[model samples]
Each structure stands twice: as C-alpha cells, then as structure tokens.
Target: MSEYDDDFAEQGQAVYEALLARTGEAAPQPRLEPTRRVLDLLGDPQRAFPIIHLTGTNGKTSTSRLIESILRAYGLRTGLFTSPHLVSFNERIVLDGEPISNEALARNWDDIRPYVEMVDAELAEAGNEPLTFFEVLTVLAYASFADAPIDVGVIEVGMGGEWDSTNVADAQIAVFTPIDLDHVARLGSTIAEIARTKAGIIKPAATVVTAAQHPDALAEIRKAAERDEAVVIAQDVDFELTADHVAVGGQVISVRGRAGEYTDLYLPLYGDHQGQNAAVAIAVVETFLGDGSQPLGNDPLVEGLSEVTSPGRLQLVGIEPTVLVDAAHNPHGARSLAAALDKYFDFAETVFVLGVLGDKDAEGILSVLAPIAARIHITASSSSRSIPVDELAERAAAITVPGLVHAFDSAEDAVFAAREWANEGTSRLVVVTGSVVLAGEILDLAEAEEWKKA
Candidate 1:
C-alpha cells in the first residue's frame, strides 16, 4: 500500500470484507428485479445525477474514462462508474475525477448498508435469493455518486445494455462503441442481434453517439434511435479521426474532427481504433456541453485526453523488455489489440499472455490474436467464468503457429514464463490479453508488487 493507502487501509479492508461477506458469489447471469428493488429502496439515487450511458463490446471502459475526464475538466464534479476495476473496487467509482477515497467509501457504505439490508429482507420476503454481487455494487456506486453530489455520472454497462443494472439510470447522452459478436449466449449470435441488445440504453430524446461501422450494427442502432427519436451521431459521418501517427516512443496519437478540426490531440492509448474512440468521446462531450444545460468547452477537451490515464487498455507498464496489459476480451477487441501490436510493437518478437471466460468465443479471439503473437502464454484468469488452464492450453496447442505455446494456472506464472521465453537482449514484447477479469487481476497483482517495492 502507498502512504495514502496506509492511512485508510484498515477502513478500506473492513468495508471490502463487509461487502465480500454480503455478496460472495460472482454469478454471470444477472436478474433485473433485485437490482430494481435495491434502487427503488434507495429512492433511485441514479436519477439524481445526470448520466452518460455507454455500452458496447469494446472500448466502453476507455471511452467512459475519457468521458469522465472530459466532463471533470469542464469544472463539473463528475462521477464515473465502470466495471471489473483493474486495481481496486474504488477504481470502479470516481467522483470529481478521483477514485472515491477509502474514508468516503466507508461513510457511503455506512449510509447505504441499511438500505442494502432492507432490500435483502424485501427480496427474501418476495421468496427470492438476495441481490447478486453486481446488483449490490451498482447500488453502491449510485449511492456513492449521490452522496458526493456530483453534477454528472458517466456509467458503463456491465454486459448487454438492456436489463443491465446500470441501465436503471436515465441518461442524457448514450454512447455505443463498436458492437460485435461476443456474448452469443445471452445477447445474440449476430451483429444485428447484439446491436439491438446494446441499443437498449438509448433513452428517448437523448443524444446517441456511436462508432458502429457495420451496416448491420448501424442499421439496427439507427432504427432504434429513430424509433425513440433520439439524435444520433456516428463516426466517419458526423465526426472523424484525422492525422493519426505514432511517435517513436510508442504513443498512438491522433487528432479528431467534429464540425471543425481537432489538432495535435494525443491519446496515450494504442491502436488505430482509439482514434475513433477519441472522436466519439469528443462528439459526445461537444453534444453534452452544447446542450446549454452543462457547458463543457474546448479547454476541458484539450486537457482531459491529453492528461488522461487508465490501466489495462493497451497500457505499456515496463520498458527494456516491453510488457503491455490490455483487457481485450471479445473478438472485436482482439482484432484491435492485434493491429496495435502489429503497428507499434511489430519489431519485437511478441509473446501473448492469453486467457478467456468459458462463455466467450476463445477460438475466434485466438484467431484474431495468433497472427501477431510469436509465442503464446495461455493461463486461467481468477474468475468463475474463466476457462480452465488446461482447456486454454489445449486451444493454444490446436492453433497452427510457428511459435511456442504454454499454459499455467495463474497469469503471474504465465508472465514469468513469457519473460523466460523472450529472446535475450532483443527488447521482446509480452502482451497480457484476453478476459477483463483476468487482465484486472494481473494488473492488481502487478500494481501490488510495485507498491511493495515502493
């Protein structure tokens, strides 16, 4: 723990322990009614804050972070609620551009714990199991934001948007980042089907910003927005990314264009796809600020993306032997990761540390990632959804590649194994990718190790 963590570590641990004891099982399937009951009991705190709802298969977290930073830069006290936090649960909830402090978190839990208990009692009375882990977390986030008295909240959907617990909020702006085939079991098998599922967050009369390029995705979203009469802004049509170039230092940088041009804009994220993400973020901010209700101007836009930082989204953590951590779970995200690795770190003999949830299309993702990886390190992430380490190893072994493939029980072991396999003094690149839960655990472990050193 840092000095800051040292000060509040006990309180934080207590709160986390309480939360863990209350909701221990992390089930994949989510029911809506328990969450609905919890929010209703809390008097719907989600409605108290203005919301920007974002849903998609990829770039949701990064886009949500960008939106939060931009909104905060505009001088508004902002609350950001994203999922599968890389380091801490507090990382999932940010107020005024900062992670909710342990002190504040304890206080909020104290205030909300009663409500949580009441909801649990009510659910029991209704002959139902208690609220699931995510439902409670969503309720906690809303309560935290409400207690903070934020001007606006940027919320990212955990899975498919419809019936998602986060979709409980009334959003003034809805963002859809590149939808693709990922969750076929729950969402759908085809792009159009998944697009329809994700389009559920676009409230009537709200402004919708999307980076969907597929005809199926665009058509589905367009129809949904048209039916709702929502104003829709899309990439390559309303706005665009221009002048993208990577510096020798490996920063994937670019400029965005709205009605006019955004010059010298630098996003520390990698991949050509991030240009679209930045563009979508800029468009969403422009719309929200121009709404005349909450005026966020160009200064915030310039400062926010320029200074913004996030972990495990094409994040390069170490030098010499370049090590990157990206939580690209789905095929769309895998393609983007593969492209980024090809573009910026192509010179290095790349080793990919890979794993996936059982529900995800692991083979499809591997197909996208295999071309760029000179070696593959397969490992099981620390989630119930995780595919077994042996299963992952089997999949990697099946792939026809001219490189090494190995599996391990944990991501750390895989990391170490990759490092050992890397060419001597060649500046080899090791990328930890696959499931978000896996990536987040690896990131948390890495950060904890770094903290110990400090």
Candidate 2:
C-alpha cells in the first residue's frame, strides 16, 4: 500500500477505536436529545438533503440498500447509512453506492470531534452520560453526507425508531420492513409495543411505505400515520408482490406498485421476503420521485434490482461444499433464512455452523433452524456479547435430535469440521448463521481462503 493509503487506513482505525470507547449499540439510550445537541453544534447537517428513514425487525438493511441502489440508478447522488455493519465501520456510511472512502470518514470525524466533545462536556456537567457509539456515528454520517452534498440520504434506524439517534432528522419518506418480536428487552415484549416504537419515525405530512405487517403492528403504524397526517402506501393495499419465481443466483419478481404494475424485474437476492422488500423499495422510490403517482420506468427498475446486493443474506461463500452464510440473529430472520434454504437449494443434507449473541433468542433461532439441519456445529463469534459455545450447544441439543449437535471453540473450527462432513456426502451443503458478527467473520475467512474457487 502507498504511504497515503496506510495513513488513511490508520486514521480510519483511530476513528473507529474512538467510537468504540463509547457505550455500545447493544445498550442504546432511549433518548435523542444528545444526538440533536451534537448535530445542532454541527449546524444540523442532516437538514442539507432530503432523507428516507427506515426501521423494523428484519430486512431493514436489504430494503435500505435496494432503495439507495434504485435512486443511484436514476442518476441521483445518494447517501445511505445503515447500522451493525457486516465488516468495516466505513460500511455503515455509504456515499452514492460505495462505502464512504476512508479519507472522507476520517476527515468527517475530524470535523465533528470538537462538537462531539462539547456535547460530552455539557452532558457531564448535567450528570448524564455522553454521546453513544451510534449517536456519534449518526452525526458523522450526516456530516459526511452534507460534505458530499448528496441529493438524498437513506438512513436506517439503529434500533427502535422514536428514540433512535437517527430520529433527530425529519425524513421525507418513512419506510418499515416486517416488524416482529425481536429485541424484546430494548424495543418491547409484544409486537404492538414494538411497532408503536418503530412507528415513531413517521414525520408530519411525510409519505410512508411498508411491507406486509402483522395486524397489531399495522394498527400501530396506522395510528402513528394518523397523528402525523402522513400518507401510507402499504403492501397488499397500494402495492403488492405480484409474482416471485426462483432463478439462477437470485429470483425474478413482479410488483404492483402504487404508480403502476412492474413485471419480471429480476432481483439478485434470495427468498420471497426479498421480493417483498423490493416491492417496498419500489413504493418508496415512487413516493420519493413522483409522489406515488408516476411509474418508475423499466430502465431504473431493471438496472437497480439487477445490481443490488445484500451481503450475508443467504449469500454463497464457498462452492465445493456449497457453503452459505446468513445473518439471522433473531427468529423472524431465522425463519426467512430457513425458508430460503428450503426453496432455493436442493441439497440432500445440510450442516449448520451456528453462533449467536447472548441477547438474541438462541432457543427460538435453533428451534426454527434445527428442523432442516442434518447436523449443527455450534460455535461463537468474536463479539464479547456472543453466547458461549457450550451454552449454545446445550440449547441446540435440548431442541434437536440426538447426535445432531456438536460444539467447537471457534467459528473457524466449526466451519472446517462442517465442510469436512459435507465433503463426505454427494449433495451436501454447509451453512454459517446465527449472528451478523459470525457472518462477517466467516466472510473474511472465506475471502482469505478463496472458498469460492473449487
């Protein structure tokens, strides 16, 4: 690497470490004033461009990416911010369609560090905690977007909508993917309560686009939209996924959008849920570009969906044993992953390399995934929050058949053993799942090991 490249990488790493020093995302504060204060100090850069905000239990990242890609396909300069990055911290703040360059990430952090410290000092005087990891990250994103002078920003809520750090910005369009019973401790125990919290993202007179939600969840969203006087273009009402057929590398889907019927749009992602997400993305773009009245022509729709990519969502990492990795940390996501495996692949036998975070519902995830597994090799990711391998294995053993669960100390060992076992049979597959951290670790390993080459 060049000296400038090395220095830029070092600066980026320094900024990441500084953010890591704050309270982590696992324990987000249920307040937004701190984020607002810092942004105010930075002259509210979030106001520089229009924003499309997204929140929900699952598929938020995929739906957000889809929206950003379509917007970029239409020749608009787009900024996308999503949380719980799979690999790099830079991944969370995207400019146009690429992760923000390391130089820009570091430069933005430099520009905002003084304002962040001012907020920290003010909070300390008031006997309150300082800004959090997500709060500072959100500020950096807005500042970077403003500096880039993007035409629009697509921001995903790091957690519950109302108090999430990203809520400091009023969005032109609010989008919700499927709401479910994940993050019960932080969001809510019941679907209605969780949905109520997520519904907080809707702003006055804004346009809302949502996937098909549970009745209770839908009711809560409707209540919020009523209060905000927002127009909701919901799935199965204003638009729907007309058809989804499995195809090579992804699937072909047709959507009846609010503006018009779009057919045979090939989405390069797996599962019926992805098709639903695409429909929501289409509606969001319609609401953004044409007030939900004019059809997005076939060019942008085709080019956007064809090039869209959602890493770690039923993504293939290896070929000889057909290894796939998915970030299904919760039951809602696990259900989707399991269904995709069943529908998209024709393996005679499957082995899962599983690791989950302590806060996640490991039992629920295992119950949903175990039914389709020939064997499960339990492991843990590098996160301090990861559940221990022994605990996860015991949980799996209690719910699965005898001799179907095995424990390993690391994800590498578990995946190695699973691959060896898969090689023993003629139509066998290996899957790594349970947590986003695990998915990222295995993705890095796969890249280094050249797992895609036979």
Q: What is the C-alpha lDDT of each candidate?
A: 0.79, 0.93
Clashes of each: 0, 0
Q: What TM-score would every model get versus the actual structure?
A: 0.91, 0.98
lDDT for each residue of candidate 1 in 1-454, tens digit (9 for 90 to 100): 2357557877877877776665543344356777777778778888897899999888888888888887777788899988877767778888887788888888887877887889789878988777666777788899999988999889998889887888878898989998888778888889999999889998899888888568999898899999999988888887777667885543544444444566766677777787678878878888777752333355667788876776788886655456778988878888888887777666557888998988888888888878767788889877877899998788777874644677788888998777666636485787888887777776776665562232
RMSD of 2: 1.3
Assess the local accuracy of residue 130 in candidate 2 as a C-alpha lDDT between 0 and 100. Answer: 92
* lDDT, candidate 2, 325-365, per-residue tens: 99988999999988998899999899989999999999999
CA-RMSD of model 1: 2.8
lDDT of 1: 0.79
Could you tell me the lDDT of residue 419 within candidate 1? Answer: 63
RMSD of each: 2.8, 1.3
Pick out the ten consecutive residues of candidate 1 with the lowest summed lDDT.
Answer: 249-258
Residue 311's lDDT within candidate 1 is: 76
lDDT leader:
2
